[model samples]
Target: MAKARILIVDDSPTEMYKLTAMLEKSGYEVLKAHDGAGGVALARQEKPDAVLMDIVMPGLNGFQATRQLSKDQETAGIPVIIVTTKDQETDKVWGTRQGARDYLTKPVDEDTLLKTLALVLRG
Candidate 1:
Protein backbone atom coordinates (compact mmCIF):
# COMPACT_ATOMS: atom_id res chain seq x y z
CA MET A 1 0.00 0.00 0.00
CA ALA A 2 1.08 3.57 -0.57
CA LYS A 3 2.03 5.65 2.43
CA ALA A 4 -0.44 8.19 3.77
CA ARG A 5 -0.04 11.80 2.67
CA ILE A 6 -0.16 14.63 5.26
CA LEU A 7 -0.58 18.35 4.71
CA ILE A 8 1.17 20.54 7.30
CA VAL A 9 0.07 24.16 7.63
CA ASP A 10 2.27 26.29 9.82
CA ASP A 11 3.79 29.77 9.57
CA SER A 12 6.85 28.71 11.53
CA PRO A 13 9.62 27.33 9.39
CA THR A 14 11.19 25.51 12.30
CA GLU A 15 7.96 23.78 13.23
CA MET A 16 7.31 22.89 9.61
CA TYR A 17 10.77 21.43 9.17
CA LYS A 18 10.54 19.46 12.40
CA LEU A 19 7.15 18.02 11.64
CA THR A 20 8.15 17.26 8.06
CA ALA A 21 11.19 15.41 9.24
CA MET A 22 9.20 13.37 11.72
CA LEU A 23 6.48 12.46 9.23
CA GLU A 24 8.94 11.70 6.45
CA LYS A 25 11.02 9.51 8.72
CA SER A 26 7.89 7.58 9.59
CA GLY A 27 7.31 6.90 5.88
CA TYR A 28 4.57 9.39 5.25
CA GLU A 29 4.37 11.79 2.32
CA VAL A 30 4.41 15.40 3.55
CA LEU A 31 2.90 18.41 1.76
CA LYS A 32 3.53 21.89 3.16
CA ALA A 33 1.73 25.26 3.24
CA HIS A 34 3.01 28.43 4.88
CA ASP A 35 -0.38 29.93 5.61
CA GLY A 36 -3.96 28.87 6.16
CA ALA A 37 -5.17 30.13 2.79
CA GLY A 38 -2.55 28.16 0.94
CA GLY A 39 -3.16 25.24 3.21
CA VAL A 40 -6.87 25.34 2.50
CA ALA A 41 -6.21 25.49 -1.21
CA LEU A 42 -3.77 22.60 -1.05
CA ALA A 43 -6.10 20.54 1.12
CA ARG A 44 -8.95 21.05 -1.31
CA GLN A 45 -6.84 20.32 -4.37
CA GLU A 46 -4.66 17.54 -3.05
CA LYS A 47 -7.13 15.97 -0.67
CA PRO A 48 -4.47 14.52 1.54
CA ASP A 49 -5.33 11.83 4.07
CA ALA A 50 -4.91 14.34 6.90
CA VAL A 51 -3.73 17.81 7.82
CA LEU A 52 -1.65 19.18 10.72
CA MET A 53 -2.70 22.78 11.30
CA ASP A 54 -1.29 25.65 13.34
CA ILE A 55 -3.79 27.98 14.99
CA VAL A 56 -2.08 31.38 15.25
CA MET A 57 -1.45 32.40 11.67
CA PRO A 58 -1.44 35.87 10.10
CA GLY A 59 -4.64 35.34 8.15
CA LEU A 60 -7.30 32.66 8.16
CA ASN A 61 -6.30 30.97 11.38
CA GLY A 62 -6.25 27.22 11.77
CA PHE A 63 -9.72 27.12 13.28
CA GLN A 64 -11.21 28.92 10.31
CA ALA A 65 -9.28 26.84 7.84
CA THR A 66 -10.25 23.64 9.56
CA ARG A 67 -13.83 24.75 9.53
CA GLN A 68 -13.65 25.41 5.83
CA LEU A 69 -12.04 22.06 5.16
CA SER A 70 -14.49 20.16 7.29
CA LYS A 71 -17.58 21.90 6.00
CA ASP A 72 -16.63 21.63 2.35
CA GLN A 73 -18.02 18.53 0.66
CA GLU A 74 -14.83 17.72 -1.21
CA THR A 75 -12.58 17.88 1.86
CA ALA A 76 -14.94 17.18 4.73
CA GLY A 77 -13.70 13.66 5.16
CA ILE A 78 -10.12 14.71 5.67
CA PRO A 79 -9.16 14.82 9.35
CA VAL A 80 -7.43 17.93 10.72
CA ILE A 81 -5.21 17.86 13.78
CA ILE A 82 -4.44 21.21 15.39
CA VAL A 83 -0.81 21.69 16.39
CA THR A 84 -0.22 24.98 18.08
CA THR A 85 1.22 26.70 21.13
CA LYS A 86 -2.24 27.36 22.46
CA ASP A 87 -2.72 24.74 25.14
CA GLN A 88 -5.69 26.09 27.00
CA GLU A 89 -8.89 24.12 27.42
CA THR A 90 -10.80 26.79 25.56
CA ASP A 91 -8.45 26.56 22.64
CA LYS A 92 -8.95 22.83 22.35
CA VAL A 93 -12.67 23.12 22.75
CA TRP A 94 -12.87 25.74 20.08
CA GLY A 95 -10.64 23.75 17.80
CA THR A 96 -12.88 20.73 18.09
CA ARG A 97 -15.87 22.88 17.48
CA GLN A 98 -14.17 24.06 14.32
CA GLY A 99 -13.99 20.39 13.25
CA ALA A 100 -10.51 19.41 14.23
CA ARG A 101 -10.20 15.67 14.72
CA ASP A 102 -7.44 16.08 17.29
CA TYR A 103 -5.31 18.78 18.95
CA LEU A 104 -1.67 18.90 20.02
CA THR A 105 0.35 21.62 21.67
CA LYS A 106 3.62 23.15 20.53
CA PRO A 107 6.94 21.40 21.06
CA VAL A 108 4.89 18.38 20.16
CA ASP A 109 6.04 15.12 21.62
CA GLU A 110 7.15 12.60 19.01
CA ASP A 111 5.37 9.67 20.57
CA THR A 112 2.16 11.57 21.20
CA LEU A 113 2.08 12.89 17.67
CA LEU A 114 2.68 9.45 16.19
CA LYS A 115 0.04 7.86 18.35
CA THR A 116 -2.49 10.54 17.56
CA LEU A 117 -1.80 10.17 13.85
CA ALA A 118 -2.30 6.42 14.07
CA LEU A 119 -5.53 6.81 15.97
CA VAL A 120 -6.93 9.48 13.67
CA LEU A 121 -5.96 7.60 10.51
CA ARG A 122 -7.45 4.43 11.89
CA GLY A 123 -10.80 6.09 12.38
Candidate 2:
Protein backbone atom coordinates (compact mmCIF):
# COMPACT_ATOMS: atom_id res chain seq x y z
CA MET A 1 0.00 0.00 0.00
CA ALA A 2 1.10 3.55 -0.55
CA LYS A 3 2.08 5.56 2.49
CA ALA A 4 -0.64 7.83 3.76
CA ARG A 5 -0.06 11.53 3.20
CA ILE A 6 -0.92 13.58 6.26
CA LEU A 7 -0.99 17.35 6.58
CA ILE A 8 -0.28 18.69 10.03
CA VAL A 9 -1.28 22.31 10.78
CA ASP A 10 0.12 23.87 13.89
CA ASP A 11 2.04 27.03 14.79
CA SER A 12 4.41 25.35 17.23
CA PRO A 13 7.56 24.32 15.47
CA THR A 14 8.47 21.94 18.25
CA GLU A 15 5.12 20.19 18.14
CA MET A 16 5.29 19.95 14.38
CA TYR A 17 8.73 18.42 14.55
CA LYS A 18 7.68 15.89 17.13
CA LEU A 19 4.60 14.84 15.25
CA THR A 20 6.48 14.73 11.98
CA ALA A 21 9.15 12.51 13.46
CA MET A 22 6.59 10.15 14.91
CA LEU A 23 4.49 9.90 11.78
CA GLU A 24 7.50 9.59 9.51
CA LYS A 25 8.87 6.85 11.69
CA SER A 26 5.56 5.09 11.21
CA GLY A 27 6.11 5.29 7.45
CA TYR A 28 3.65 8.03 6.62
CA GLU A 29 4.27 10.93 4.27
CA VAL A 30 3.84 14.13 6.25
CA LEU A 31 3.23 17.68 5.05
CA LYS A 32 3.18 20.61 7.43
CA ALA A 33 1.92 24.18 7.79
CA HIS A 34 2.82 26.60 10.52
CA ASP A 35 -0.49 28.41 10.40
CA GLY A 36 -4.08 28.05 9.29
CA ALA A 37 -3.94 29.85 5.97
CA GLY A 38 -0.92 27.88 4.93
CA GLY A 39 -2.65 24.73 6.06
CA VAL A 40 -5.65 25.47 3.90
CA ALA A 41 -3.48 26.18 0.90
CA LEU A 42 -1.48 23.03 1.39
CA ALA A 43 -4.63 21.00 1.77
CA ARG A 44 -5.92 22.27 -1.53
CA GLN A 45 -2.65 21.83 -3.35
CA GLU A 46 -1.43 18.62 -1.79
CA LYS A 47 -4.70 16.74 -1.35
CA PRO A 48 -3.38 14.93 1.70
CA ASP A 49 -5.17 11.83 2.90
CA ALA A 50 -5.84 13.42 6.26
CA VAL A 51 -5.26 16.63 8.17
CA LEU A 52 -4.22 17.11 11.77
CA MET A 53 -5.30 20.68 12.48
CA ASP A 54 -4.66 22.98 15.40
CA ILE A 55 -7.45 25.24 16.52
CA VAL A 56 -5.51 28.34 17.55
CA MET A 57 -3.64 29.98 14.70
CA PRO A 58 -2.67 33.48 13.57
CA GLY A 59 -5.01 34.42 10.73
CA LEU A 60 -7.54 31.78 9.75
CA ASN A 61 -7.44 29.31 12.64
CA GLY A 62 -7.92 25.56 12.27
CA PHE A 63 -11.67 25.55 12.59
CA GLN A 64 -12.09 28.08 9.81
CA ALA A 65 -9.50 26.36 7.66
CA THR A 66 -11.14 22.98 8.14
CA ARG A 67 -14.48 24.50 7.31
CA GLN A 68 -13.17 26.00 4.12
CA LEU A 69 -11.51 22.77 3.03
CA SER A 70 -14.55 20.70 3.87
CA LYS A 71 -16.85 23.02 1.99
CA ASP A 72 -14.69 23.38 -1.06
CA GLN A 73 -15.41 20.87 -3.81
CA GLU A 74 -11.76 20.35 -4.60
CA THR A 75 -10.83 19.36 -1.05
CA ALA A 76 -14.05 18.46 0.69
CA GLY A 77 -13.29 14.73 0.97
CA ILE A 78 -10.14 15.15 3.02
CA PRO A 79 -10.66 14.05 6.60
CA VAL A 80 -9.69 16.69 9.16
CA ILE A 81 -8.89 15.78 12.74
CA ILE A 82 -8.65 18.70 15.15
CA VAL A 83 -5.69 18.49 17.52
CA THR A 84 -5.58 21.29 20.03
CA THR A 85 -5.48 22.25 23.70
CA LYS A 86 -9.19 22.85 23.76
CA ASP A 87 -10.59 19.97 25.86
CA GLN A 88 -14.06 21.28 26.38
CA GLU A 89 -16.94 19.23 25.00
CA THR A 90 -18.27 22.33 23.31
CA ASP A 91 -15.00 22.74 21.54
CA LYS A 92 -15.14 19.20 20.20
CA VAL A 93 -18.72 19.69 19.13
CA TRP A 94 -17.86 22.94 17.43
CA GLY A 95 -14.88 21.37 15.73
CA THR A 96 -17.10 18.60 14.41
CA ARG A 97 -19.63 21.14 13.31
CA GLN A 98 -16.87 22.88 11.39
CA GLY A 99 -16.24 19.58 9.52
CA ALA A 100 -13.51 17.90 11.54
CA ARG A 101 -13.84 14.14 11.26
CA ASP A 102 -12.39 13.64 14.73
CA TYR A 103 -11.08 15.69 17.68
CA LEU A 104 -8.03 15.24 19.88
CA THR A 105 -6.58 17.39 22.63
CA LYS A 106 -2.99 18.57 23.02
CA PRO A 107 -0.33 16.28 24.48
CA VAL A 108 -1.70 13.70 22.08
CA ASP A 109 -1.05 10.07 22.86
CA GLU A 110 0.63 8.23 20.05
CA ASP A 111 -1.56 5.16 20.22
CA THR A 112 -4.77 7.08 19.96
CA LEU A 113 -3.43 9.32 17.25
CA LEU A 114 -2.41 6.38 15.14
CA LYS A 115 -5.64 4.57 15.81
CA THR A 116 -7.68 7.57 14.77
CA LEU A 117 -5.57 8.01 11.69
CA ALA A 118 -6.04 4.38 10.76
CA LEU A 119 -9.77 4.62 11.12
CA VAL A 120 -10.02 7.79 9.12
CA LEU A 121 -7.58 6.96 6.37
CA ARG A 122 -8.68 3.43 5.62
CA GLY A 123 -9.34 3.30 1.88
Candidate 3:
Protein backbone atom coordinates (compact mmCIF):
# COMPACT_ATOMS: atom_id res chain seq x y z
CA MET A 1 0.00 0.00 0.00
CA ALA A 2 1.11 3.57 -0.60
CA LYS A 3 1.96 5.65 2.43
CA ALA A 4 -0.23 8.64 3.21
CA ARG A 5 1.13 12.06 2.29
CA ILE A 6 0.85 14.73 4.97
CA LEU A 7 1.67 18.42 4.63
CA ILE A 8 2.69 20.10 7.87
CA VAL A 9 2.64 23.91 8.11
CA ASP A 10 4.26 25.57 11.09
CA ASP A 11 6.90 28.18 11.80
CA SER A 12 8.44 26.31 14.70
CA PRO A 13 11.26 24.14 13.49
CA THR A 14 11.13 22.04 16.62
CA GLU A 15 7.45 21.35 16.27
CA MET A 16 7.88 20.57 12.60
CA TYR A 17 10.69 18.16 13.35
CA LYS A 18 8.74 16.44 16.08
CA LEU A 19 5.62 16.01 14.00
CA THR A 20 7.58 14.99 10.95
CA ALA A 21 9.38 12.37 12.94
CA MET A 22 6.18 11.06 14.40
CA LEU A 23 4.46 10.87 11.01
CA GLU A 24 7.47 9.30 9.37
CA LYS A 25 7.74 6.75 12.10
CA SER A 26 4.18 5.79 11.42
CA GLY A 27 4.89 5.26 7.68
CA TYR A 28 3.78 8.55 6.16
CA GLU A 29 5.39 10.69 3.48
CA VAL A 30 5.73 14.22 4.78
CA LEU A 31 5.73 17.61 3.05
CA LYS A 32 6.33 20.90 4.87
CA ALA A 33 5.67 24.65 4.74
CA HIS A 34 6.82 27.32 7.16
CA ASP A 35 3.95 29.76 6.80
CA GLY A 36 0.35 29.94 5.70
CA ALA A 37 1.05 31.27 2.21
CA GLY A 38 3.54 28.56 1.58
CA GLY A 39 1.15 26.08 3.05
CA VAL A 40 -1.51 27.06 0.59
CA ALA A 41 0.91 26.84 -2.30
CA LEU A 42 2.09 23.43 -1.23
CA ALA A 43 -1.44 22.22 -0.79
CA ARG A 44 -2.31 23.31 -4.32
CA GLN A 45 0.82 21.83 -5.80
CA GLU A 46 0.99 18.61 -3.84
CA LYS A 47 -2.65 17.90 -3.10
CA PRO A 48 -1.58 16.01 -0.02
CA ASP A 49 -3.85 13.50 1.60
CA ALA A 50 -4.04 15.67 4.69
CA VAL A 51 -2.62 18.89 6.14
CA LEU A 52 -1.49 19.75 9.68
CA MET A 53 -1.66 23.53 10.10
CA ASP A 54 -0.55 25.95 12.79
CA ILE A 55 -2.88 28.72 13.94
CA VAL A 56 -0.34 31.50 14.24
CA MET A 57 2.35 32.48 11.80
CA PRO A 58 3.98 35.52 10.19
CA GLY A 59 2.41 35.57 6.74
CA LEU A 60 -1.06 34.03 7.10
CA ASN A 61 -2.83 32.41 10.01
CA GLY A 62 -4.10 28.87 9.88
CA PHE A 63 -7.72 29.94 9.70
CA GLN A 64 -7.17 32.05 6.61
CA ALA A 65 -5.07 29.41 4.99
CA THR A 66 -7.58 26.71 5.74
CA ARG A 67 -10.35 28.85 4.33
CA GLN A 68 -8.45 29.42 1.14
CA LEU A 69 -7.63 25.76 0.76
CA SER A 70 -11.17 24.69 1.46
CA LYS A 71 -12.56 27.15 -1.05
CA ASP A 72 -10.24 26.32 -3.86
CA GLN A 73 -11.58 23.78 -6.29
CA GLU A 74 -8.28 21.96 -6.70
CA THR A 75 -7.55 21.57 -3.01
CA ALA A 76 -10.98 21.62 -1.42
CA GLY A 77 -11.10 17.90 -0.73
CA ILE A 78 -7.84 17.72 1.20
CA PRO A 79 -8.52 17.41 4.91
CA VAL A 80 -6.92 19.97 7.20
CA ILE A 81 -6.31 19.35 10.88
CA ILE A 82 -5.48 22.47 12.88
CA VAL A 83 -2.68 21.83 15.34
CA THR A 84 -1.94 24.81 17.50
CA THR A 85 -1.56 26.29 20.99
CA LYS A 86 -5.03 27.81 20.90
CA ASP A 87 -7.03 25.51 23.15
CA GLN A 88 -10.46 27.00 23.55
CA GLU A 89 -13.95 26.13 22.52
CA THR A 90 -14.16 29.21 20.35
CA ASP A 91 -10.91 28.41 18.64
CA LYS A 92 -11.99 24.86 17.95
CA VAL A 93 -15.32 26.05 16.62
CA TRP A 94 -13.61 28.64 14.43
CA GLY A 95 -11.20 26.11 13.08
CA THR A 96 -14.05 23.86 12.13
CA ARG A 97 -15.85 26.80 10.61
CA GLN A 98 -12.78 27.39 8.48
CA GLY A 99 -13.33 23.85 7.18
CA ALA A 100 -10.82 21.88 9.21
CA ARG A 101 -11.63 18.23 9.57
CA ASP A 102 -10.20 18.17 13.09
CA TYR A 103 -8.62 20.41 15.73
CA LEU A 104 -5.76 19.46 18.03
CA THR A 105 -4.08 21.50 20.73
CA LYS A 106 -0.36 21.93 21.08
CA PRO A 107 1.73 19.40 22.93
CA VAL A 108 -0.45 17.06 20.97
CA ASP A 109 -0.71 13.51 22.24
CA GLU A 110 0.72 10.94 19.84
CA ASP A 111 -2.16 8.52 19.97
CA THR A 112 -4.86 11.09 19.50
CA LEU A 113 -3.07 12.75 16.63
CA LEU A 114 -2.53 9.48 14.91
CA LYS A 115 -6.10 8.39 15.45
CA THR A 116 -7.44 11.63 14.07
CA LEU A 117 -5.21 11.31 11.04
CA ALA A 118 -6.42 7.80 10.42
CA LEU A 119 -10.03 8.81 10.78
CA VAL A 120 -9.79 11.76 8.45
CA LEU A 121 -7.85 9.88 5.84
CA ARG A 122 -10.17 6.94 6.02
CA GLY A 123 -13.14 9.14 5.27
Candidate 4:
Protein backbone atom coordinates (compact mmCIF):
# COMPACT_ATOMS: atom_id res chain seq x y z
CA MET A 1 0.00 0.00 0.00
CA ALA A 2 1.08 3.54 -0.61
CA LYS A 3 2.07 5.65 2.35
CA ALA A 4 -0.34 8.37 3.38
CA ARG A 5 0.54 11.95 2.56
CA ILE A 6 -0.02 14.41 5.39
CA LEU A 7 0.00 18.17 4.86
CA ILE A 8 1.25 20.15 7.85
CA VAL A 9 0.32 23.84 8.06
CA ASP A 10 2.25 25.80 10.61
CA ASP A 11 4.22 29.03 10.66
CA SER A 12 6.95 27.82 13.02
CA PRO A 13 10.01 26.34 11.42
CA THR A 14 10.92 24.35 14.54
CA GLU A 15 7.45 22.82 14.76
CA MET A 16 7.50 22.00 11.07
CA TYR A 17 10.87 20.35 11.34
CA LYS A 18 9.82 18.34 14.37
CA LEU A 19 6.61 17.13 12.74
CA THR A 20 8.30 16.38 9.43
CA ALA A 21 10.99 14.33 11.11
CA MET A 22 8.51 12.37 13.19
CA LEU A 23 6.13 11.65 10.34
CA GLU A 24 8.92 10.81 7.93
CA LYS A 25 10.41 8.37 10.39
CA SER A 26 7.03 6.64 10.51
CA GLY A 27 7.03 6.36 6.69
CA TYR A 28 4.40 8.94 5.90
CA GLU A 29 4.97 11.45 3.12
CA VAL A 30 4.89 15.00 4.42
CA LEU A 31 3.80 18.16 2.61
CA LYS A 32 4.52 21.47 4.28
CA ALA A 33 3.03 24.99 4.13
CA HIS A 34 4.19 27.98 6.15
CA ASP A 35 0.82 29.54 6.76
CA GLY A 36 -2.88 28.84 6.44
CA ALA A 37 -3.44 30.41 3.02
CA GLY A 38 -0.62 28.48 1.51
CA GLY A 39 -1.80 25.39 3.30
CA VAL A 40 -5.29 25.77 1.89
CA ALA A 41 -3.96 26.24 -1.60
CA LEU A 42 -1.70 23.23 -1.28
CA ALA A 43 -4.49 21.10 0.10
CA ARG A 44 -6.74 22.08 -2.76
CA GLN A 45 -4.14 21.30 -5.38
CA GLU A 46 -2.54 18.20 -3.90
CA LYS A 47 -5.53 16.66 -2.22
CA PRO A 48 -3.36 15.12 0.46
CA ASP A 49 -4.81 12.28 2.52
CA ALA A 50 -4.94 14.40 5.65
CA VAL A 51 -4.04 17.85 6.95
CA LEU A 52 -2.41 18.94 10.23
CA MET A 53 -3.38 22.56 10.77
CA ASP A 54 -2.14 25.22 13.18
CA ILE A 55 -4.59 27.79 14.50
CA VAL A 56 -2.54 30.93 15.04
CA MET A 57 -1.13 32.22 11.81
CA PRO A 58 -1.09 35.37 9.72
CA GLY A 59 -3.47 35.68 6.74
CA LEU A 60 -6.05 32.89 6.87
CA ASN A 61 -6.01 31.10 10.24
CA GLY A 62 -6.40 27.34 10.57
CA PHE A 63 -10.03 27.57 11.62
CA GLN A 64 -10.95 29.48 8.47
CA ALA A 65 -8.91 27.16 6.33
CA THR A 66 -10.53 24.10 7.88
CA ARG A 67 -13.95 25.57 7.39
CA GLN A 68 -13.18 26.32 3.77
CA LEU A 69 -11.94 22.80 3.16
CA SER A 70 -14.83 21.17 4.99
CA LYS A 71 -17.40 23.16 3.13
CA ASP A 72 -15.92 22.88 -0.31
CA GLN A 73 -17.03 19.88 -2.34
CA GLU A 74 -13.60 19.04 -3.63
CA THR A 75 -11.93 19.07 -0.21
CA ALA A 76 -14.76 18.18 2.15
CA GLY A 77 -13.89 14.51 2.26
CA ILE A 78 -10.32 15.16 3.27
CA PRO A 79 -9.91 15.05 7.04
CA VAL A 80 -8.25 17.93 8.86
CA ILE A 81 -6.62 17.58 12.27
CA ILE A 82 -6.01 20.79 14.14
CA VAL A 83 -2.54 20.85 15.70
CA THR A 84 -2.11 24.04 17.63
CA THR A 85 -0.88 25.63 20.86
CA LYS A 86 -4.44 26.46 21.77
CA ASP A 87 -5.44 24.02 24.50
CA GLN A 88 -8.51 25.54 25.98
CA GLU A 89 -11.71 23.49 26.04
CA THR A 90 -13.40 26.16 23.97
CA ASP A 91 -10.68 25.96 21.39
CA LYS A 92 -11.21 22.25 21.05
CA VAL A 93 -14.90 22.75 20.57
CA TRP A 94 -14.29 25.47 18.01
CA GLY A 95 -11.90 23.26 16.11
CA THR A 96 -14.52 20.55 15.88
CA ARG A 97 -17.05 23.10 14.83
CA GLN A 98 -14.70 24.12 12.05
CA GLY A 99 -14.76 20.45 10.94
CA ALA A 100 -11.49 19.12 12.28
CA ARG A 101 -11.49 15.35 12.54
CA ASP A 102 -9.23 15.63 15.60
CA TYR A 103 -7.31 18.18 17.68
CA LEU A 104 -3.85 18.07 19.22
CA THR A 105 -2.00 20.64 21.27
CA LYS A 106 1.54 21.84 20.73
CA PRO A 107 4.35 19.78 22.19
CA VAL A 108 2.27 16.98 20.83
CA ASP A 109 2.92 13.43 21.98
CA GLU A 110 4.32 11.41 19.11
CA ASP A 111 2.36 8.33 20.04
CA THR A 112 -0.90 10.20 20.44
CA LEU A 113 -0.41 12.00 17.14
CA LEU A 114 0.27 8.78 15.28
CA LYS A 115 -2.64 7.04 16.95
CA THR A 116 -5.07 9.82 16.22
CA LEU A 117 -3.80 10.01 12.67
CA ALA A 118 -4.20 6.29 12.19
CA LEU A 119 -7.69 6.41 13.60
CA VAL A 120 -8.75 9.27 11.35
CA LEU A 121 -7.22 7.62 8.32
CA ARG A 122 -8.99 4.39 9.16
CA GLY A 123 -12.28 6.23 8.95
Best by lDDT: 3
| Candidate 3 backbone overlaps, count | 0
Candidate 3 lDDT, 1-123, residue by residue in tens: 999999999999999999999999999999999999999999999999999999999979999999999999999999999999999999999999999999999999889999999999998
Candidate 1 lDDT over 24-84, as tens digits, reads: 9999999999999999999999999999999999989999999999999999999999999
Candidate numbers, best lDDT first, in rank order: 3, 1, 4, 2
lDDT of 4 by residue, 16-103 (tens): 9999998999999999999988998999999999999999999999999999999999999999999999999999999999999999
The C-alpha TM-scores of every prediction are 0.99, 0.97, 0.99, 0.99
* Evaluation by TM-score, superior candidate among 1 and 2: 1
Return the clash pairs for model 3, or none: none
Please give, for residues 24-80, the per-residue lDDT of candidate 2 as tens digits.
989999999999999999999999999999999899999999999999999999999
Model 2 error, position 58 (Å): 0.5
For model 3 the TM-score comes to 0.99
Better of 2 and 4 by lDDT: 4
The pairs that clash in candidate 1 are none
Off by over 4 Å in 1: none
Supply the global lDDT for candidate 4.
0.96
lDDT of 2 at 60: 96
Give residue 117's lDDT in candidate 3 (0 to 100).
100
Model 2 stretches astray by more than 4 angstroms: none
